[model samples]
Target chain A: MSGDTRHGVGVSPGTAVGPVVQVAPPVRPPDDEPAPADAEAATAQIQAALATVAGDLDAQAAANAHAAPILKATAMIARDKGLAKAAAKHVGAGLGPAHAIEAAVAEYAAQFEALGGYFAERVTDLKDVGDRAIAEVLGVPAPGVPSLSGPSVVVAHDLAPAQTAALDRAHVVAIVTEAGGRTSHTAILAAQMGIPAVVQLHGATSLEPGTTVAVDGEAGEVTLDPDMALLEAQRERRERRAAALAGVSGPGATRDGHAVALLANIGGVDDAVAAGAQDVEGVGLFRTEFLYLSATALPSVEEQADVYRKVLEPFGSRRVVVRTLDAGADKPLAFANLGEEENPALGRRGLRLCQAKPELIDSQLAALALAARDTGADVRVMAPMVATAEEAAWFASRVAAAGLPKSGVMIEVPAAALRSRHVLAEVDFGSLGTNDLAQYTMAADRMEGELSDLLDPWQPAVLDVVAAACAGGSETGRPVGVCGESAGDPFLALVLAGLGVSSLSMAPKKVAAVRFALSLHSLEECRALADTARAARSAADAREAVRAAASPELTAVL
Target chain B: MPQRTVTIASSVGLHARPAALFVEAAQGTGLDVEIGRAGEEAVDATSILGVMALGAKHGEEVILTADGDGADAALESLVALLSRDLDAEEG
Candidate 1:
């Protein structure tokens, strides 16, 4: 073998070759740390260490406006008088300074965990603060992403939001994490920043810090000590991919002139503004959860409308398909949480939560209607996690009552996809949320990194589901589109188009490649590729079969 | 001492931004303020850790007491802050 190769989930598309730089995990107090001979001096040291951490975080906050609130809050935690007193109490009880800090942090962490929900989530922020203080007390280097000296592939167990936010983007060429699913913070941030990233790589942090490695983010492969020939090939492919992407622009179309609306999937106003400046037609997925996730109370309709307006104003008359709040399970809103469940994925979430609390959906629909009227944008509202025709009808009636033009439902539940003909009859259109669809179809939890194989969008079963949903859409004369991670994959985009998906929505940066991929194939050729993939025995085989069937020019760049 | 009883209006209760804002406001006041559930042990209102550890939730009742200069004015202002949904306001 030219070099040892490791596999992971390719979250962000691209390639990079650079030396590895491992991010150090949070520091722990030494088990055998001895008690200080002078308790007063120990207490003083503990206080000073916390203050230093607070000061450092404050400085960092001052420099990064995007991360300022988070950093400032962490700094505030460091300077808490209650925390200081707790540590001092531990010091008086004969624990070393570092040990005292750990005990104090654990005390508060236990309280936060006991509180549960949003309070429990704060425990991570608390622990980060504690780790920083402990590092200072022990006179060790701070834990988390270190300052990069040059372009490097950074490896870590899992990157926290704070760590990812603080990364030296200019010098960090690629990211490999031992843990994190496709929807994890690291994966989302990497995709948004357009950096090459591979997640769920086992033993990723074990690579020698200075060892040269080649990261093929598209292939989810990391090769140690890559040979000169492999590196040269990667460099040439990078150039060729760029040139190919540059050559193709404007609205997406097949070689035969079959139209495929390429669009962006955005979460909020900032994402909308950025995506609007790109070459895509308009937003295909507008996730509205960001407004409610952070709020302790539901935002007023006016407040919601203002945010929606900002998101819609960018697209003008272009279509912006908005998905109503998708919460519960992985992302729980404290205000709207439906309590704990053994199986949150299958529990009351998305439209189910909306059904139980009609007021929530009512307010959201009202806001979307208001924003649509004000901005004059072609706004279409969709409900997530709809499992039945009745659910779709119920949502459609509400959408009409709110005066919104078009109503749609996300065909994520297999039941909905199976009966989509009936479901689509009740709505204006449909969109496939392939991520959750695959998760539910394969009986795999999307959050379980170990089950990534089952969650792969290339699985023949998932393709069948997509084809079934498309058949339903065609039967009802309703357009169906894909607004999921799979839509961003160039090869998969063609497959979706072949399955009769009228639109493909992905990250703004990924739109170009998918658009270019479509430009190389005719509708007939895409259908042939789709048929070949669906006939395969396994996900890997399906992918290989499609790759083998695709035009060589198209596959070369990918 | 001036005391006021107010129900937490924030949908998330007295936590996160509300807790931080409440603590900052309490600290800005030159009075010694304490907050707690009725008939429970009170914590320093100016301490963010203590306030967050209180584990207060939306629609829960809290008792605020302050002593020293401008105690009445401080308690009144604090009560006003707690009456609104602080989390709903834009940053």
Candidate 2:
């Protein structure tokens, strides 16, 4: 075996070892490639290419009505006069139509990419035009995932969202890319699909196709033609970890028997059902954003209640902590949009947005109450972005008035964390949304990949804030759960338990690892670990300190 | 020159389906049309990127201008288009 190794940032957990098959980037037209000399013929050539691409897209739009808006929009781009005129100008200048088309599209692509956000998303649509047009002119099959014959690790420079969507999960065991970060589409998709992926690998694309490769998503290691001993070691380690997790289930607790409930953080019915199938104790945080985000209409109490019932039906008697409609400027409800806001993060969002439209808040509360009654699930209601004791009291009253079993408030805003004891006095429980809490406390937008350092959950400041919220839970004798994206990490779950978090709620797939991690450490050990973490000066250092002091077996699995 | 000043009525205002549909309608007019936010430089209406780049929000005023034989007709058509909630219309 040709033993070789490389490292990159691993965005998803687990390990994968298979033959490497590189997914080639879309073919680019040569920059200096000359166009046809005859201006009239070149014009017709460009016109024909555009027409074919537009027709193909139109057909695609028809075939995929759900995607018609985006596909048809791209088709319109193919027919836009600006592109045709730009191509014609180049043809007139003695450049071939291909060169002209490339240049023309580049201009629009550059503009769209620069606009960022919404316009930036449209860059893919524009570039889709270029790729299809270029493919038509070149007579090459449209660049996309090539049919694979067997399980293989697909390596690439970068996979466009379309290409990623087209990827055959049956054939690709893992994705290795040269240019992507944790926040990139590839990483996000990989996480969603529960695939092990290593991104930003420097020479990922250069790996020869069909070479046996092994990827450790946790370690972010890529090994080419690995020796059998190394492969066996990875297999045995994985088996050991799986076996340990398999030995334990039910509510999470430590070796010394201090109770820690391992719960699921669900978004909608699908998540609830999937998590219900796992060994989780109950739903700790049920995000109600999907109810509002899914459609244009402000759902009626009956419609909302019906969906909540479906989600709660899966859990039966298990507790489902349902968060009220959390529509914000970022995730705007078509019917309840407050128009454009310059600072959406700081502006009307979550509880504030719902407050702006009391009907939205009222109907959602009524739905949760009715759904809880219909499904007979142990339901607890919560409000997101509650920054003050008054807001908490208001949310609790609404939940109580609706006949909900209990009430809670999310600790996302820094203000909520600082005065959490007072806020907790008003609600039945408090859950730390570490993702948003990290963002607000660190003064960094979690969406911005460049600011990931400050948004790291392990950051001492973020942990300190979480500890403060948990302290509130103690003062009020209400359970505090970690329901952010961070709770999924086994190490972070341990740290959360150490900080007095009563429940660990995360994606269901992560429950096993966290459950096993909890069994390896006692509550006292967790507190000591948290103390070591809080004393650390940096996120990386805190993680290392915790890992250094953690049980040897636990650290190995982590 | 024939022109019209109209407020954007689409809920999302000149973006996504609304923006693309707006551009397609403008292209159908044949007569060259330019659109811009009030007091801002107008750009070619036929270009979706250019139109969306205007970032015209709901209830915000935008200026649409066109020239030639059907210039007034073009402006009228565009004004009518912007005055409706294009997003609610069936695709």
Candidate 3:
């Protein structure tokens, strides 16, 4: 049993070997507790507990700058004078510190819960403070993730988003959860943070808190008390991967010199700055919705331009494709909240929402134009979810009228892909949003996990729609690109290039891998792979066919 | 005691980051600061819960009252803070 290995789904790609540290679940106060003989002393004791909890939270917030806002907010709940006064009064009435704190928090929690919306979420914060105070008073280890002093593998029954957010990421070498899947918050965040993660490892939390565990995220294997040789081998493999990726850089091209402009997908000014530093060709998908999504009012053209300038300024002369504010029923922009809808997925969204509020679209266009001119960057604005040629033309003219350099339409809808020539004629470029194209083609909700199978980008139908969109671009001599999750997948990136996509944009972290994938084979080989994938009967079959035909090196990394 | 009235400039009103910042600033002053909606009962400006419970929205006028030697200075600072878009700076 020296080589005992437990298998699970590797949600993130990497390997880590460290001691396990189980995050203790929130402790509950005993329902019944005898009152202290001295009422004043009991009240003082609870007050000290509250202060200690508050101090701990304040220290934690100070330690991690990113968690300061949330942690400081929770610390306020703990140090709340009103909460303390009520709890002390309860203690004066002969209730125990734990019970008093719980009751006091509950009183505030009810008020917050009644307020609804964003306020309603604060009840959890209040409860967390209550839990900490209760744990401190009872002399128990604090609930939630315990602070780590060394590199560790965090073992949890299931990480709540709050706990996941609060974890001291520097100390966490790997994350193992007994529950959650690839799409779980833990997995998604782990991937984004570049952490090695394994999910659904049934008994991960049962491991002794300080025992060593070797986690292989790529292989989805957890080895308990792994030997030195195994750890060294894993380290060597990681180094090799790093070396391979380091070998490929600059503008992406195949061995046969078929140039594919590999660009980064950026969400905000921060993302734009970070991605701009990476080895990508340029910014292919500068998502502008994030700026609008976080605002309560429609930002003025100047305010919007300031944000756009922040994003475009970093890229300089590099091409930056910005998607205009694309919010609607589901996303619900605060300035233009359309309210509850029967079918938000099929309802007014993206460009459709822009039509309902031309002022919003016009303001955004003016801002983009101003930002483009200010930075001297090549900015091509795009419209999302454009279904018809008229909508595409409407968006292109608006973009031109605002003095933006170029216009493009996201080919996300099936209608746009099928009648691509008409849509392509109205726009300067076509960017296939494969994720949504798959969702629309299969009539699957992009968000609903149950419909995830139908939304798989590897499905032949999805590829066919993408091919149609690409063909439209080729016919019109307009450049076509992919700015979807599919573009990030290196093997799929090849298929896209084969289908005539001139560029690919994805999360900045994925650039190195996709670049490496492109460097392996010629454009003709990519076309053959795409042909093989399209001829498959199913998504699984398509993936397998591509894998079978792919170079061994591609299969190894993918 | 000194008091100043100011309109909330934060688009999200006097809650979230704005409320937190206001409470933090009030606590920093070490003076008894009370804030209330026009003609309403004042709550402790240092208490996040009390401040949040006010449910003040954007463009709503609120009165700030402070006691102690620096009371006038504190009220003026708070009023100035409330007049500007505090949330906008954070974003």
DockQ of each: 0.55, 0.23, 0.58
CAPRI rating of model 2: incorrect
DockQ (C-alpha) of model 3? 0.58
**TM-score of chain B, candidate 1?**
0.98
| Residue A483, candidate 3: alpha-carbon lDDT | 91
| Model 3 spans with C-alpha error above 4 angstroms | A23-52, A83-145, A156-164, A341-347, A435-456, A459-461, A471-477, A534-541, B1-4, B9-12, B25-33, B39-42, B65-77, B80-91
How much is the lDDT of residue A449 in candidate 3? 51
List per-prediction Cα lDDT, in the order shown: 0.90, 0.81, 0.85
lDDT string for model 3 (A1-558, tens) is: 335789886766778899989987777778667887887888888889989999999988988888888998888878889888989888888788888888898888888766544565667888888888988888987878877789999998777877876888888999998876645566666766677888878788788889899998866789998988998888887887788889888999987999999998888889888988878778888888877875667889999999899999889899999988778777777678776679987888999999888999999999988988888999999999999999999998898899887999999998998888899999899898887788899987766554655777889999999998888888889899999878877778888888899999987877887899899989999999999999999987997798789888865754
Clashes of 2: 2
Each candidate's interface RMSD (Å, one decimal) is 1.8, 3.5, 1.7
Q: Which wins on TM-score, candidate 1 or candidate 2? A: 1
Q: Give the per-residue lDDT of model 2 (tens digit) for A129-177.
A: 8777877777776655555678888888777677764466667788898
For model 3 the local lDDT of residue A414 reads 89
- Which residue pairs overlap in candidate 1's backbone? A296-B11, A296-B12
